[model samples]
Target: MYLLGLGLVLSLLKYLEVGPVAAWSWWWVLSPFAITALWWAWADATGYTKRKAMEKMDQRKQDRINKHKEALGIQPRKPR
Candidate 1:
């Protein structure tokens, strides 16, 4: 995501002929996009993306349970 943003910024700067970026080759300006693509591909292949999604879901579930417990006047269990 960050790489994508960087790529976009670099592209804009290159397009507008800004400073040193103006002299940079399009390949260099666009490299971050390629890196971002590679990162995504690697993450997907390694299940990193799925793992993060699962962790997020688990956290949301725990937060929901904690909210219910608090509403019932029970303390939420401490996280390990």
Candidate 2:
């Protein structure tokens, strides 16, 4: 995400010929896009993205269950 943002900022700076970025070549200005793509590809290939999503979902589900139990005045379950 940072890479993506940097790419956008650099591209704009290069386009407007502003700052030191103005002297950089187009490839250098656009390299962050490639970097971001590679990062996402690696994350997906390793199941990191999917694992994170699933962990978040499980956490939400546990929170909801705990809230219901609290409302019913039941004891919290012991962790394994």
Candidate 3:
């Protein structure tokens, strides 16, 4: 995400002819986007994206359960 943002900012700066970025080659200016694409591809291939999504879903599920437990006067489990 940070790489994607950096790519966008650099592209804009290059487009507007701002600072030293304007003098840089298009390849250099556009490298971050390529890097971001590679990063996503690697993450997807390694299942890192799926794992993170599942972790987030688990957290939400736990939070919901805790909220219900609290409403029922049960103490929520402590986080590890």
Candidate 4:
């Protein structure tokens, strides 16, 4: 996640004592890690990630079915 990357960059900068970040408190620098953790937890607990993955998988399955039907020159079934 962007937050984790930001935390990593900030941590490196703080460790190396580079720029104005050198004066920043470790708490401030590490806050993005906590934010990322919380975001991941919230997303997982809400099934958001699972829903997205399932949607993608369903799309792939539909595509495969359609491709097979096209190859066989089969007509789609009419609805009752």
Local distance difference test, per candidate? 0.98, 0.97, 0.98, 0.93
Q: What is the lDDT of candidate 3?
A: 0.98
Model 1: residues with Cα > 4 Å off, grouped in runs: none
Error of 1 at 13 (Å): 1.1
Candidate 4, residues 1-80, lDDT tens digits: the string is: 99999999999999999999999999999999999999999999999999999999997987788779888999655435
Residue pairs in candidate 1 whose N, alpha carbon or C atoms collide under 3 angstroms: none
TM-score of 1: 0.93
lDDT tens readout by residue for model 1, 1-80: 99999999999999999999999999999999999999999999999999999999999999999999999999999978
Give one digit per residue, the lDDT tens place, for model 2 in 1-80. 99999999999999999999999999999999999999999999999999999999998999999999999999779768
lDDT of 4: 0.93
Which candidate comes out best when scored by TM-score? 1
- Tell me the tens digit of each residue's lDDT in model 3 across 9-73: 99999999999999999999999999999999999999999999999999999999999999999
Model 4 ranges with Cα > 4 A deviation = 73-80
The TM-scores, one per candidate, come to 0.93, 0.90, 0.91, 0.79
Model 3 segments beyond 4 Å from truth? Answer: none
Point out the worst 10-residue segment of candidate 4 by lDDT: 71-80
After TM-score superposition, the amount by which residue 42's alpha carbon in candidate 3 deviates from its true location, in angstroms, is 0.5
